[model samples]
Target: MKQFNTTLMAAMAMAIGLSGAPLAQATTPDNQLVIATSLAQVLSVDPQQGTEPKTQEILAGVYDRLVYSDDAANNTIKPQLAETWEIDNSGITFHLRQAAFASGNQVTARDVAFSLTRLLKLNQSASAYYKSAGYNAQNIDSLVKVIDEKTFRIELTDKVTAEDLLYRLAMGISSIVDSVEVERHVDHDDYGNAWLRTHVAGSGPYTLRRWVPNETVILETNNRFWGDAPAMKRVIMRHVPESQTARLMLERGDVDIANALTAPDVKSFVGNQAFRVEQVKIGGFYVLAMNAGRKPLDNPLVREAIAYGIDYEGITGTILGPYGRQRNVPVPEDWAGAIANPDWSFQPEKAKKLLAQAGYPDGFSLTLKTIAQPPRVDIATALQANLAQIGIRIEIKQGNGADIVSAHRARDFDLLLPQATAIMPNALGAMNDFVTNPDNRLAAKNAGNFVWRSAWDIPELNALRNQASSERDAGKRAELLTTLQEKFVAAKPAVLPMFESFFPIVLQKSLQGYHTNLWSLNRLEHVTKTK
Candidate 1:
């Protein structure tokens, strides 16, 4: 491993920044860390569609949830907006923290209530009260009753587990927002929170300073932050779409950190001594979601054939090289519900047999929709090649992120290579988002419309998921999780779930104290320039 003394590298970078020889050098201040990413803007902070990490960064700064899954500290739910809470026989009661708001208003229980109501209106999956009670936004409007300025009550329609409710609350969508600001722009009846989407007023560590659409978003530190003040003065998230351009910026000392680097591009800095690369295993799963409500997929054998046809090990070894792993289950190993099942392994012979049984000896051509991402593109190519060996012909249709999402929702294509995101740590959360949740646009519905046609239905699966949610016993939950994973594997509703790639933050050696957690929450606090 070729390496340089971090202290020496920091000094050199600082000297270059101070000297101001070039545009990249001059713009990157001693305290400012410029990070580049290819993530296009789908900017709705409503946690229902908040898949992009770029959007998460902005949300992390502008919002504060009652409980944050602190990955930097053993993946525990640390106190944030609600410092702590107590659960009695009646219901859970949160003790509000006195935090300064961005709008200079006092943070209270009313703000929490408003935020939850907004989340319900937006139909966010992260709303724990809704999910546990098996309620939607409309259900929320009826259930939540404000007790006092600091206390609230959720009367469950049915009996709910205490743990399930807590986990749901820990999701990012449950973040508190000011009620007054919400009502200012929201009409009595509207599906969207158009005003709060762009303009934010929350009690977080940083305030949204500027968002120049497709170019860059600048944020400044919240001086009256409730917790420890961040060491860095500001954070600049530059939208550099090209990986080559981002790589060039990092090499030239123009940017401090860059995320979503390609497998080959990472090789450039693996041996370079000027920067430090930190790779974190983000909690997500890459899947080829099939429209099960459609013709061929409606047949169980065809779905199973497609599952068997995927050479997961081959893709990881050849296409992904060192940047990926073949994951069987949707959840990560560190998570609560990762199943250990060897039966779900790839079997080309079984795949071909299933195809023949499904009355297709020579597979038919189907359109596979994907974004213009290098990883997905590579995966598509590999899948096409592998499937061809078993007589499955796949035609690739590439488009922009928004276009792909539209097509996916419309059910225009046969298959899609989109990732599944978890609202919380449990397997139930993952299952609920992808399989159970009706409002989830990417779920069982025929395309984006609410025509449920996914080839999956199980009272047992549903019961297991519900049981896992409220079950307080760790051992029992794990056992139930394994059973649920088996059910999914047996009836491959989605394609083979692949392991998430670890995102590396390549930054100048001078920056320190950056933190990342299991949930992939990147905190910019404690990051200081020593040189």
Candidate 2:
């Protein structure tokens, strides 16, 4: 067995070792914390499109939203930017919090107005968020109405659920910025503290100090935050993409925390005495999407055949491990309106029979594009093995995370494994982005310009979705969900192989006050050094 060492644990080994001698006198033992992660670089700190776990982890420290989900309390939206608000016939109104600030100025209704408006106007790379937030109404024309400097209203163009706007605020784009700063960068869709992409100016419990990509990022406690300061004076996050390396670092005491350790590695951490591992089954799901516009896949019978061909049980059990939940439908059971379909059973014989009926006695050859990351690789391999049983020969194509996403967007592959962590605490996000939107659909990810042809159009399905979106009554929404689920399995939008794999966070046993939210970063604000 390889022994874990501090020098090998954190990628910032040289900096942490050398910088310590100079700052030793000023630092208290409890004032410093180090996090080890499986990220190559800090992709983007701007919340608009920062969907990766690492970005969310870092942003959670450097930014705050209008309302935040209390992970400990069943993911309830607690007040952050707004103190309270009421929804009347006119629209939803929010009473702004008086003490919030981004840098130095007070966070006002104008900032909220600016943030919401920018999301509609900028067409920044973050524009993908609009699809996910269900603000599909072009330009978000019905999004907001500023009642005053301290109050704002969101008037829906059509009857819609509060869940839609709530999820939008929860997204990174919803993090308010100074109105003046936003104006300065208005021409630059990438603006809002361009300096913040590498540095930060938010009013969260922590502030960015230094970011050296692929090496380390350092954050200091935010003195101007409206709430209590973070327990640690400084936080150092080292980018270590290798799972074994992260585990070794945690074991050696070089890194105080290690995130996203795989299932096998979780067992190793549990066997060790110095560390503790935590996990949550979030709303993320991995899928094998086929091109609906191309030959062999254009037929609905073929798509349906492929859907029933794979063994979800074997895939989840072997590739995802014991904790992983098998999903028979596109939506996870944990979501509010999850529609479970028990009929989509794993039947390879049925798949082969369907393929024969679809014109090919022998299954066709196709390519599978996926990220080079371990989880994706695992899913791809499992898919390959399962598809082989049904006579389909798949060529696996892999690349970096960003490259894979770009490739998908460009329609570069025949089949692709794409995973999305839905903007949970709100299922409407999933509906808008994956189900209804054309751009976000799986076939859109293929570089060949292949579109996900929704041939299984059921008027009942559309009606249920609309009902779920417009109904204010919780009972009616639940009833709509039941109707939707029944219709969805019959249409087969996408295959849900496994429930979300658990996001694992391993930490030093002595670190106290740790918390993880399903939608936000693990709350490190109240964390303390128990030792």
Candidate 3:
């Protein structure tokens, strides 16, 4: 059905025929749910350090922030740890709910204060959100204070918008940790990262049962969870890298959910009575990232040529099908300040003219590297064919997701095809990494970020991105976003997104309450299996 890498497809074909493998028929308990996916890298479970999508999936279930919001709830502020919050002239003070950590430590204001202080002290992957708000090593401890056991306060150095602060605190990176639990595991300068990557310390619904690196991660429901108990007592996340194998496992009743099935793999199950397939449009965006500092791509006209050269509709219609949408803006089309379905058609003559304008009338050759998958390869082949007509000698290279992503980070490739998951639903969430480029040392903590690799230093765009948070006025903020997109499009800033795509989440018909947001976050607390 769905096309994958040729080699992987062959292996899957073999595995499908050998479905008699003991694992396929291993009786699944009704109380246990098995999930299959391709994990990129999960270095740490510490909310401040986990960076990959799989890491987010697990951490989202294993940790809880002070406040939470989702698309269905209109991204409005909702209480989680902090039951209520009040904003004042100086700053905002949050009233911590009477909750206890997995370790049975009553989550007091000291724990909250300690968690925020630790996050800033580590200055790991997600501290950029606070760093942007003017917290650093020196003053972060001084600014954040505690008032008694129930109240915690975050006093800011500079003025900030409530909208920005709310969403920042709502993010997974802001998940509150058990200060004492983390301290017990901290190693020499490691800050508990090595331990947290494989363990859990938050007050969320699930606790880590086991994590076998690239093989599997098992999560058992927290019996002492502050909220309602989870329906599935155990969530088994197995690393089945091949889509066809995952599909077969689902058909064989081995796993309850198959997260990374190929499109064709999903199509064959169209009318099946036992299984159901869902292609949810998450907050992930694909882009053809170029090193703006490099040659040829450095030319504005050349970058613009490549931008006009992509056949967004043709490839999306064929390879992507209903699984992806073609949109021009970074944010989802439904959100404000979003521009949808713009005319980025296949234009050979225009591309040639732009190339000539950039002093490359004969066109130039460059290597385009992407994940070695059928759909991705098909898209790259389409681009190669389309640009060839304009005298561009494009070389297509393929690798696993990790190899390609690592190469992009090193500036070792001419172009790379990658996807970015939206941290939040808004425009700021989509482009935060682009605007908040810090030193490589800071970025290494997160790893696999393209903004730092592009080596772009646009102060104007940075200021504009910062302005959206401070502006506060909804209409004026939208206007600022419109102008920002216009400038980014005009500049053709290294990243050229072909389309926004979705992935299929196949499961049994009886399972309910497994809705993922634009960012592909599914809270598994309420998922129930009637069958």
Candidate 4:
């Protein structure tokens, strides 16, 4: 193993033009934290435009939301820019802390108001939450108001509960920006969307130093930050997309942390004292989405047959291994309002019986679309094998993640294996994504809705989602959510959730205080490195 690592490091050095020079030191600089991760999905760093998880992780350090989840469980709320807040039926009022932007502008309620107004005006992917809550560009300015230099208020619509709105505000989409700094670069009435794509106007503990797309991202400490200063002076995230390459770089001490390692690579560091493997429950599920718009799949019995045919234990134990575990329900078990595990298990006989009832006694052939990446490809292969046992023939077709997702969004696939996560850390978020499909028409173009992508439209589930979203009482909300999940499982929806994902990350032993949460908001401000 040692010899293999050495050979790998040498090959990497030669490939990257470091063959003739001294290789990177075995120990990284004491004041810097280097990370190797895939930035393929990170198209923009703008808080209002960047929707990818990688982009959210990067912005977490450079920007501050009004509030933040206290921990991975997302059970409590903590203040960030807002020192305190008061929630009531009509709206929420926030008391802003006396802080300064990286650009030296005072952090004020007006900036918060403008940031939200700009978010709605841009109408990017980040605006989905606010739009769902009944806010739009025309009325957003009136909804978000500045009472004083330190006070901000956001009016609530009848469609959403205060708790629901608060959870949404804690997300990266609600990140407060420096209104003065951003407005200076507005172009063609774009509301600084064009400039923010490449630049950051936040007041968090880090400032964007340099960004070369798909190559490297550099962040330096923001000395003017009002909160506790970050221990690491600088952070450098290098794009290392391949798991093997990231493992080699991490083993050689060229990087301090590696994100998105395969199960095999993660196991390689299990007993090594020099490295630590950490897993965070990201509250997402790996699901098999059957396009109901396609014939045969449109029948509920056929969808149930597909679900029964899956070898949940086999896949979770082998293919997923340490990466994930079986979770049949749409809502993750750790989250609030989750129902007890259902009696869904692998029973080929039951699957065959259901198929025969659905008028496919001879079985049928279909195409399965999946992302060409770790675990996903392997999981798709496992699904193919399991379904074949029940007389279903699955032709596996693979593509890049983006292409596969584009096809799924277009409802152009018979079966799609994709990992779906809640936009917020709440059951409502999951229901909104996996169960609510207000309009099922192709002309609706509701690409963001996963249920719509699967072409599953159920008015009863939609009504339940609305009730749960607007329920103010915690007890009543929990009951409503429980009923929602029960009804979803009973309906045998087109989306069959297989496992809950536990995101695995590796770090050098010398690194400390590195934390991650459900939204991938890995704030590096608290991270420290020892040499």
Instruction: Score every model by TM-score.
Output: 0.86, 0.84, 0.87, 0.89
Off by over 4 Å in 1: 1-27, 46-51, 124-133, 153-160, 321-323, 334-337, 343-347, 426-459
Sequence-dependent TM-score of model 1: 0.86
Q: Tens digit of lDDT per residue, candidate 4, span 72-141?
A: 4444778889999998769999999999999999999999999899888887756766766677789997
Q: lDDT per residue, candidate 3, 37-78, as tens digits?
A: 866455567787665667878887888788876656666778
List the global CA lDDT of all models: 0.66, 0.65, 0.73, 0.83
Q: Judge candidate 4 against the unseen true structure and give its global Cα lDDT, from 0 to 1.
A: 0.83
How far residue 353's Cα lies from its native spot in candidate 3, in Å, is 2.0
Q: Distance from true position, residue 373, model 2, in Å? A: 1.9
Candidate with the greatest TM-score versus the true structure: 4
The 10-residue segment of model 4 with minimum total lDDT is 1-10
The candidate that wins on lDDT is 4
Winner by lDDT between candidate 4 and candidate 2: 4
TM-score for candidate 2: 0.84
Tally clashes: model 1: 3
Q: Candidate 1 overall Cα lDDT vs. reference?
A: 0.66
RMSD per candidate (Å) reads 4.5, 6.4, 5.4, 5.1
By summed lDDT, the worst window of 10 consecutive residues in model 1 runs over 1-10
